[model samples]
Target: MAASSGRFESAKSIEERKEQTRIARAEVLRQAKANFEKEERWKELKRLRGEDTWMLPDVNEQIEQFSKAIAMAFSRKPT
Candidate 1:
């Protein structure tokens, strides 16, 4: 009977630990999502105010412009 009681106690402890871990992970995810939304809101506000928001340029466009500039520079032979 004592062995059965011990098993039951261990099972309960395991369940409690699992529940705690789940709660902690959920809280962390919630905080991360909130932070991301806040940042997006700030960017939107800046946009509405005609302020430049930091954003990455399109990689393909940048590459095309860079290639053109390099070609133009090379075409002009050193005087």
Candidate 2:
């Protein structure tokens, strides 16, 4: 009976170790996937920003253009 119990305990320990290893491996894989996704998002954003340069005009220029458009629209006095 004692020998059988020892064997059972050993088997249980082995199973526990295997489960722990599996959980650790799964965590590592999850972290790697997350990092890869984050990097991909950053890359996509950088690409969309257009060759490391912002294509939009300065704020003052944008405001000026908007004001001009508004003035033109008001002056047109309906088709």
For each candidate in turn, the TM-score is 0.55, 0.54
lDDT of 2: 0.84
Q: Alpha carbon lDDT of residue 11, candidate 1?
A: 72
lDDT of each: 0.85, 0.84
lDDT of 2 by residue, 1-79 (tens): 7776653457789899999999999999999999999999999998787755554558657887999999998889765
Q: Give the range where candidate 2 is weakest over 10 consecutive residues by summed lDDT.
A: 51-60
TM-score of 1: 0.55
Residue 66 error for model 2, in Å?
Answer: 41
Clashing pairs in 2: none
Worst 10 residues of 1 by lDDT: 52-61
Model 2 residue runs over 4 Å out of place are: 1-9, 52-79
Evaluated at residue 22, the lDDT of candidate 2 is 100
